[model samples]
Target: MPARRKDPAIPAGLKIMAPEPAVRLAKEAEIGGLGLDWSEQPEMLDDVGLAEWERLAGVFAHDATRFREGERAAITAYCSWWSAFATAAADVRDRGPVVEGRSDMDRGRLVKNPATVAMREASQQLRYWARELGLTTDARVRIGLADQGDDKNDDDNPFA
Candidate 1:
């Protein structure tokens, strides 16, 4: 089997590396901006996508240092996926997940709705983008953006 894909190296800015080591590593793995304008929304995005972009942008603004201009495309992709997911989910909600099949053989049978499939695909893509952008709780913890605290709680047992 092929070797497993390696996780992307954490940017020097995200870690607590020493100044000397950080500077040395910078020469080999320097992270730079792409000069993209963040103020304007991408022309390709529709109204739903624009709203998603705005929502994500607002969340990212709180930790602007974590994200850079190089990640604009990733952010755009996340927004696009979110829009697609929202649209597909709405369709699936309006029309149930099971629908009458259009194929000749399955015409009378209730098959899965195309919108449900689209929603599933979009949801998967959204999850991937969320993890990539450190938008998920698990991603944030893994990327050192969140504190790793003990799991101790007053009601540890769910059935309690």
Candidate 2:
């Protein structure tokens, strides 16, 4: 098991939650900005999709206030993107990349299938969601996941 990190000591009258509960709450709560809780439960996703969602969720897990308020829409959007990305990626894997179809003018020649296009669009959205959710390298570094070149104690740096 990965080492369990202690929750940061909070001032009196404050509460904090671990990642898993924060994720569950974000998904299940009926938040106004998310528009009727379109987000799926973590149990609904396949392993890969679930992992991605959890990773994104963990970004805000430490900050209960952010997860509770501002991130609701973002979390739901990420879930929506995950569904699209997973479906498109799976279809491309199971079926060949090219989609076969008929042209508008004549039914004889098929216009290229839109599966590739859909996949590309979903991929782009997934990338955007990852960045927004702090899954990107720059985001991770800012959140203390990825190490910046300066390994020295940050307190020692006067600017910090």
Best by lDDT: 1
| lDDT (tens digit, per residue) of candidate 1 on 1-160 | 9998655786544756557955654543456453334577888888999998877667556554466667778989988888899999888898899889999999999998899888889999999999998888998788877543645563867864
- How far residue 71's Cα lies from its native spot in candidate 2, in Å, is 0.4
lDDT score, residue 15, model 1?
A: 54
lDDT by residue for model 2 over 1-160, one digit each (tens)?
A: 9998665675666766657965766665656233222234445556655666666556555544444444655666677777777777788778666555556664665455566688788889878876776767877776666444757778877888
Candidate 1 residues lying further than 4 Å off, grouped into runs, are 1-30, 34-37, 147-160
Where model 2 places Cα greater than 4 Å from the true spot, the runs are: 1-66, 104-111, 142-160
Shift of residue 128 alpha carbon in model 1, Å: 1.0
Report the number of the highest-TM-score candidate. Answer: 1
TM-score of 1: 0.68
C-alpha TM-scores of all predictions: 0.68, 0.49
